[model samples]
Target: MKLCILCAKQRAVLKRPKTGQQICQACFYHVFETEIHHTIVDAKLFRRGERVAIGASGGKDSTVLAHVMKQLNEQYDYGLDLFLLSVDEGITGYRDDSLETVKRNQQQYELPLKIVSYGDLYGWTMDDIVREVGLKNNCTYCGVFRRQALDRGAVMLGVDHIVTGHNADDIAETVLMNIFRGDIARLGRCTEIVTQGESSIRRSKPFKYTYEKEIVMYAYFKKLDYFSTECIYSPNAYRGYARTFLKDLESVRPSAIVDIIHSGEAFEIKSTVKMPSQKTCERCGYMSSNDTCKACVLLEGLNRGLPQLGIGKESRVRKQIAESEQKELPTVVQHFSQIQRDADAPDIIQPRDPSTVYTPPPRMPTGVLDPPTKKTLDW
Candidate 1:
């Protein structure tokens, strides 16, 4: 029987993808959890008495993340009040079943669970969206909506920080995707262990350096309950291709994932490159680079029966919105305006009319748009 390289006395059960080291179950769990703990400490991700929300998707990464966060919080006496925060995208079978797993995790981990749905937040579910927009660009709506959903959920939970289960493979894939697409703004921050954006509540990736394989092995060994099915509506074709390529490279060299992340980290954008400045969405009061947030723009498209409004060029989306404005589609504008207007004011204060909502004008920032080239929208 093969013995663990680290323990020498125990039977080897798995091989680590990052180092290709044969390790026993106990040693594997120790190293896996320890590495994440180190990442949290090195990044200074938490403080005493801080309320943290784990962005649980019921998937392997998130399940393991919930477990590790609970374990380390107790082990290190971090004094953090942890909660499980989930976004119900309203995907029929997929998200529904996955959320059940998150529910079980809540019971097992003893963390307060809060679920925010797209229907409640946006008046549209992924099911309604896919039927209207079709499969071509539906993911765009889900992606944009889900992002804001998490933040909104955190707000309701009153958490100080949000943690996601983005592992090294996911980050590495994102790094490659950003490079291939020449998204300088995203490439700059994609490798960051923590991303606080302009929102008051910070969001971080504690598993930034952990490998997916180790996370799965850890779950397997510990018998952690998690959902493994992929999102039904997720085409994920573009990302899947990148993921496959990264996996192939990993088969050849285990260190490729970490190496790519390091390379992404080493990249320094030239001083001349202009980046998008963060601004509050005029419609929703959310952090956005454009005059309006992407979610609001996409919702406008769906509500107006012109689903293509925000899927392509910003110029096209603007022209469409302008044309719609000339036609006096007050319903479309008023709906989002009301949501944003109500959301902007503190909960303690009563909401006012949409007309009374005031947002500061957009300001120019340093980052340049992708050089004027015909590019296929990822959606």
Candidate 2:
């Protein structure tokens, strides 16, 4: 048997991808937890007596994160009050099973657990949404809803910060996806260790630099109680492509994941390019780029039987809304005519009585009284 490189006493169990050093299982556990601790300390992820929530999905990444966070909190005397926050997407078999795992995690880790459901928050389940929207872009709805759901869940738990299980591989894959889609804004932020949206609770990824393979190996060797199953509703074809590409690159060069993350961190978007401005959703009062948040827009579509409303380009959705409003203009104009108008704009004609308005035919310009069409157009 190969001897452990670090201790040289125990038998080697695995070779680290980040550093191709053969180490024993005990050494692997220590280093894995220590690196995450170092990442947290270096980034200053938490403070004394701060209430934090672990965005636990019961998956290997999240499970390992929970284990490591508890270990570090106790060992380093971080004085953190930790809780497990989970979002139930209302998937029948998928989230249901995963939530059971989260419950078990709560008991095993002895942390307070809180779960929020999509059906309760948005009045729609993933099943209902998939049926209404079909499988084509269901992931969009799920992603948008899940983000807001997590924030809401964190609020319910009264956490100051939220930690997620996003690993280096996930960050690298997101970087590739953002670059491929030309999403300059996301590309710039995808590599950050912490992200605070408009929500009060700050969200961070302590495992931002940790490798997924190492996480799996850690869980396996430690025999960590965690769930290992793919989301039933997640086809994730687009991100899957990026993930596959990144994994393939990793297979050839183990450092590719960290390198991509570094590249993403190095990106400096030009100041000239306009990025989306954050605003509160008019309907739900959630953080959104538009007047209405994506979740609200999508929920409106589903409720109005126009499920395709927020699926595509924002311009296209706006156009559809404008066209629909135009189709009902006569009724709208009649309804609004009862309201008083400004006295300064007496020339502003109201369409209350169409027949009372005088119509003029088009006149041909012939002299100095009328400017040429080309000259008018130029002006």
Candidate 3:
């Protein structure tokens, strides 16, 4: 039996993928958690008393991340008010099942949970999307909607920052995918540990340097409840090819994942190569490189019964919209700023007199703003 390298007492349980160290379960837990703590501290991922949301999906990576984050915060006195934020894509057999696990985690972790469904936000669901645009390019709609859904959920929760479970392996796969597609702009920032959108709400990866295998190991040893099933519609994803190649490379060379991330970080775009500038979407006020955000465009395509409007080339899509008989397309019901204002407003409290009747104010008319009942506070 191999003795533990860190303690030299207990038997070694497993070999770490990031470092080829044979260590006991206790040491593995220590090093695995300590490294994440170091990453957070070194990157300044959080500030004292900041409300941070864990982008929980109930998958192994996200489950382990929530558990570790809560553990670290309590053990190290990070002074963070943590919450669980989930996006319900409305996949019947997939997301629906996983979300139950998230609910259980909410109870187990004693953290407030908020779920923002696609149907509620966009008047469509993954089921609705798949039914409209069959299997091909359906992931595009799901990806775009889910990204904005998370952002919208964060806004609703009024969190200062959001942390996702994207680990080194996921980042490595993204780096390779960007390189394969020659997306220079995305390749430039895909490996960043932190990112912020137009709303200035920060998004980060606390497990940016962690390994998938170690994450699984940590979850297993800790007996965490997580859903491990893959989305049924992901068989045809473009990223699968890059993931396969990356896994094959890792089998031969364990450090390939970290190396690819390092390479992505080291890449420098030339001054001559033009990068797309960020702009607000005219339809929904979300950040976009074009006039309309991808979510708004895709939603319009679905609503117009022309699901192919946002699928292909930009020129062709624009031409299709131009040739269409409809003079005006539907815009999002509310802008992002309005959503933020609603989220920041405090809940109305009941009057102090119990016997006295309390009549609530009539609902405001459409397109009209309500009078503030209390002093307005800025986020």
Q: Each model's C-alpha lDDT?
A: 0.78, 0.76, 0.83
What does candidate 3's lDDT look like per residue over 120-236, in tens digits? 898998898888888888889988988888888888888889999999999999999999989998999999999996578999999999988788778777878788778888888
Q: Which number leads on lDDT? A: 3
Question: Each model's RMSD to truth, in Å?
Answer: 12.8, 22.9, 14.3
The worst-scoring run of ten residues by lDDT in candidate 2 lies at 328-337
Scored by lDDT, model 3 comes in at: 0.83
- lDDT string for model 1 (1-379, tens) is 6678998998776666667676777888888888889999989999899989899988888988999999999999999988888899998867876777777777788777888789888888999998998887888788788888888777767778999999999999999999899899999999998787434789899988888777766776677777776777665556878999998998778799999999999999999999999887877777889878898888878888888889887998888888885452332222222333123211221223424333222221211112324232110
lDDT of 1: 0.78
Rank ordering of all candidates by TM-score, starting from the highest: 3, 1, 2
Q: Using Cα atoms with residue i matched to residue i, what is each candidate's TM-score against the true structure?
A: 0.86, 0.84, 0.89
Q: Where is the poorest 10-residue window by lDDT in model 1?
A: 360-369
In terms of lDDT, the poorest run of 10 residues in model 3 is 361-370
Model 3 steric clash pairs: none
